[model samples]
Target: MKDTKDSWQDSWFDTCAALLTDPQNLRVWSVIVSLFGDLAQRPGDRLSGGALSRIIMPAGIKPEAIRVALHRLRKDGWIDSARQGRASAHFLTDYGRAQSAEVSPRIYTRAAAAPEAWHLLIAEDGAGQTALDDLLLAEEYFSIARNVALGAGPVPEDIDDDLLVFDASARTVPAWVRLRACPPELSEAAHGLLRDLSQADALLPRTPEAISPLQIATLRMLIVHRWRRVVLRQPDLPAAFFPADWPGPACRAAVFDLLDRLPRPALAELEAE
Candidate 1:
C-alpha cells in the first residue's frame, strides 16, 4: 500500500506540473512579474534570489534566464534588488508596486462586475477627437470609434465640456460592433485558456494531500498569469459587446474553480520551502 501511494503521488506531481506550464510563448519576464505581484507585492515584501528561483523554476525557467529577467526588470524600473553579504533579495520599486496595485483588483476579481448604468461620449468628427482619444488612453473608456467612447456608471463631473455625453445601455449589438469590441484573436485566446484549464482540472488528483504549498503557489501563478493576459485585454463591457461564442465567462468560472481547490500558500510558507 505504501509503494502504491508513493507512485500515485509521483504521478500526480508530474501531471500537475505539466498542466500548469504555459504551452504558449512563455515570456520569462512576464511570468516573474505575475509571481512578484501575486506573492510579494506587500509594501515591504521581498523575495530572496533563492526564493524567487524556487518559486519560478518549476515552470521550467532556468536560473540564467531568471538572472537576465531580473536585470531587464531593474533596467526598466519595474524591480530593484539589494545585496546582503553574499545573498541578494528583490522587490518591486514604488512605481512598479503602484502599477501592480492599479491592476490588482481587476486581476484578482473572482467574478465580473457589470455596472447597472453606462454612458457614451461622442466627439465632433475632427474638433474633439484628440481629447476623446486622450480620455480613452488615460481611463477605462472603451473606444467604439475615433469619435465615440463608452464608460460604465454615471458620467463623471470632470468629463470634457466640449464632447457630447448621454446615458446609454446596450440594446442590440451587431456583428461588426461585437467584432470591434472583442476581436477574433482575443476570442481565440480566451477559448484556448478555457480548454487548457479544463484539461488541468481533470488531471488534478482527488486527494488534497497529494500537493504541497510550493506546488500550489506555482500553479496559482500560472493560472493567474494566463487569466491576466485575457482579462486585462477585455474591457468590462456589457455581454452584448462580446462575440456570440465568446468563452470568457466559461473561462473565468473554470479558473476560479481550480483556484478555489488550490488555496494560496502564505509567503513565509513559500519562502521557507
Candidate 2:
C-alpha cells in the first residue's frame, strides 16, 4: 500500500510539472532565475548544488543543463558560486537581485487594469522614430506605429521637443489597436497558460500540507516560470486596449490562487530534504 501511494504521488507530480512547463520553449537560465526569485531572493540565501538539482531535475531538465546554465549565469555576473567542502552553493549577485527585484511586483502581485490616463507621442518621420523606439523598451509606453507611441504620466521636458505629444484617453477603440495591444500570439499564450493553470489546480492536493516542501518548491517554480513568460511580454494597459476575449485577468488570478495554496517554503527546509 505504501509503494502504491508513492507511485500515485509521483505520477501526480510529474503530470502537474509537465502541464505547467512551457510548451513553446524552456530556457534553462531563465528557469533558474525564476526558481531563485521565488525561493532564494534574500541576500544571504543560497541553494546548494544538490538542492538545486533536486528541485529542477524533476521538470525534465538534465543535470548537464543546470551545470551549463549555472556556468553561463556566473560568467554573466548574475550569480556567484562558492565551494562548501566538496559541495557547491550558489546565490544571486547584487546585479541579479536588482534585476529580479524590478520585475517582482509584476510577477507576484495581482494587478488590476492600469489607470486610464494616457498620452501619445508622435515623432518626425526618421530621427524622431528612432528616439521613440527607446521608450518602448525602457518605459511603459506602447508602440502605435513606427513613429507614434502611447504612454502615461506627465510629459517630460527631457525628450526631444520636436516630437508631438497629446494627453488623451480612449473614447473609442478600433480593432487594429486592440490587436496591437494583445496580438494573436500573445492572446494564444495567455489562453494556454490559463488552461495549464486550471489543469494544475485540479491535480494538486486540496490540503497543501500534504505535499512535501521540495515538491511544493518545484511546483511553485514551474508555475512562476511559465507565468513570467506570459505576463512580462504583456503590456499593462486598461481593459479597453485588449481584445474582448483576452484571458490575462483570469490567468493572473489562477496563478496567484495556486501560489497561495502552496505557500513558499523556507530555503533550509527545501535544502535539507
**Best by TM-score, which number?**
2
Give candidates' CA RMSD values in order.
2.2, 1.3
- lDDT of candidate model 1 versus the reference: 0.86
Which digits, one per residue and each the tens of the lDDT, describe model 1 over residues 36-96? 8888898888888888887788888899999999999999999999995698989999988
Each model's TM-score?
0.91, 0.96
> For model 2, how does the per-residue alpha-carbon lDDT over 31-68 read when each residue is reduced to its tens digit?
99999999999899999999999999988999999999
> Which model scores highest in lDDT?
2
Task: In model 1, state the lDDT of residue 1.
Answer: 100
Worst 10 residues of 2 by lDDT: 152-161
Q: How many steric overlaps does candidate 1 have? A: 0
Q: Judge candidate 2 at residue 201 and give its lDDT.
A: 92
Compared with the true structure, model 2 gives a TM-score of: 0.96
